[model samples]
Target: MKFTKETRNAGRGRRDLLSVAGAALATGLAGCSGALERDGDGNGNENEDGNDGDSDSGSDGDSTDAAELRETLAAADPYRMHQYGPSHVGNAGGAGPTSDVDAVWTFREGADDSHYEIGTPAVVDGTVYVPENHSVGDDGAETVVYALDGATGEIEWEWTYPRGTAFGSTVVAEGAVVLGLGGSVVALEADAGTERWRLERDFSDAVTVADGTVYAINTTYADPPTLVAIDLETGRERWTEPLADERMFWPTPPAVADGTVYQGGVELTALSTADGERLWSKDFGNAVTGPPTVTDDACYVPLGDGTVAALESDGTLRWRQSVERGGRGSGLHPVSSPAVADGTLYVTSAWRLTALDADDGAQRWTTETAGDRPPVVADGVVYASGLNVMEAYDGAEGDRLWRYETDASSSSGDKVAPVVGETAFFPSAGLHALRGADATSD
Candidate 1:
């Protein structure tokens, strides 16, 4: 859905703009606060710093997490989800492709039509799953989901629907490529690009997988929006719940951790992954601004008020850290989705990046003008994207190591995170795979 000042409630006016812009600013740059749109390829991670690659919410949550269906992807080799995993840690283990890197390969999908933007990317095993939009017969447009070889830009397999287009992340689960395609939740065979199952929805932007279930928001014209859960193997609805009727923030793609699904709409809500049941709910004076980043210990919620509300599993308030100002068009601006590593939380607030102590919400370090795209943390580096630049910073010291300038995707709400592995795969003008300049090209 297109978000604008005229459509949203007064409380959510300024909060939803961070994604409208690109990369969460360069070092201390400026966070985006325009219009959050989408159109792109989606991708997946490794665990670093002695972090258990698998989240141990320390509860029964782990047992129910079907993310293991894509087991090996837990390593950094594959970026299975948009934010890396069900936990939404946004870490893909090792280091990022530094600024000195060179483009290993690029799959340009630019067309004359404005809606002909590429989708995000998802990497698993050695295949990169992405979507490319194309202008068809004059004003018509269609998106093609392609499974490309990771090492080479060869199209291993591709698929599209009749006059259908896709937006948001591409996910791999239950041994299939899952995506919000053709206005439906689609699962296609990873190796052959064959349809496995399809669940129709009038509109959907993001799709996430957990414990053999697919979670996403579905809407039909004037009907109220509903978050629906679909079985991974079958195209059957498991449960559906009505979303907040108000003009609130509902993260494009919801997140799941510890057997709980986290979403932002009327409020930050935690629901059971087993069934559509509310586990807990909290209000921080405004709707949730960005995707909830869930870790082993806390569920960090970015609020429209420029505050990061740290809450426990039971919805208990842990702490709140304010940004330069509220999400409104005043001070620094509100914060967007954050990446947590070790014990520090890397947040892109308006035109800056701030590192906060995960335990007490104390500021560890802050950048000057930050990029606005959601940050992806790996090894010890944090990567933030912008419309024309990608900045890498030391995860510990917050020092700007290097910056690479490139054309970011103009797709609506194209806030897809960067994929970190042997090469850094960014969803931009198309799909750009960057690697260290010293690395030998195959």
Candidate 2:
């Protein structure tokens, strides 16, 4: 129940809007609340491999019909912990290899009224661009986004977005910091904290940038949800595609790969990355709350009701796997996004953590953590948090390597996400870092 504080608080008041921190793609409204920490750059690069870690390139396979694509994405990978993609491993070569000494640097909160909560952190050059929620008053009002030293957590510069309510994560690419608030998306100068351009729209969705354009969706309870692609430089709308049904309040961020942008609503939808044309759409079962993992010819969707599905790149369901069949109680629900590492997918449901084969959807291993926070895979290890504990697990196998406990209350079940670099970062009673046994190995 530790990670559920924010949602619980919001649930007690008004459950329509929740305020999420580091993971950025948080549901609900902002207030004095708890948040999940997040790593930036989805599947960017891992230091252990010598492969060229280009963010845009992926292995290609022969294209199939949209129906087959949906089936392929649904089949479930036997080797991965997530299907959407890997949680960020931090900026390329920023921190040395994970080691002992457990080094952790934190920025002091801006003011009593301003508590520091992070969105996804982006490490570029030597700087970690963090989107921070600085609470302005007791009403949950705040200014968001900050640029900091990745290694030291020192504040380099900061800025605010217009009409920005603290929600969703910052998307940093090509020297620009981008994020979405209650109804608009804005791009800022990553270095000087200057505003480049802003897209005004009624949406709280995070913007995915690729091919010099931004992809955003508006699906709050107030309006019909539509996915919109916009030019990053000029803030011009490229194309807009409406959803199948009018269901609102989606927390899943858009995943972009190859020439397509993959996302899910009440159902799964794939759109052409270039023209915003609809490529495919599939109904999994329940709505989707996280990003869909994409392969050259396949896509994976982790459904809200605890089903892991695989689909072809064109949107056909291949197979499905459920975590509850493993004798775990159905009370564990997956709201946080899953992380993929080394062909294995990691997912968190309420109080349970699971790893599955990316190719088969077979349960490789399952373990109970302190709370149900999403796991971050790095250096062959998974970093997860629960209740009041932070834990590390063998990424290849579900073996407990180490555990760290804190007096800080664990995050609410509805809001658990972790970020990993050379070290993994978690926010509990305070902030926590998990490093490897060695300190000097880069």
User: Model 1: per-residue lDDT, tens digit, 290-387?
Assistant: 67898887889876667788988898999998865313233435577778889888877654778899999999988853256678887888887644
Candidate with the greatest TM-score versus the true structure: 1
Please list the C-alpha lDDT of all candidates, in the order they appear.
0.63, 0.51
Candidate 2 scores a C-alpha RMSD against the true structure in Å of: 12.5
Whole-model lDDT for model 1 versus the true structure? 0.63
Superposition error at 21 for model 1 (Å): 12
- Candidate 2, residues 177-244: lDDT per residue as tens digits? 77775566878887798899877656554566766777777645445667888787888888887765
For every model shown, the clashing-pair count is 48, 74
Runs of candidate 1 with Cα error greater than 4 angstroms are 1-75, 109-115, 164-166, 220-224, 245-251, 325-332, 440-442
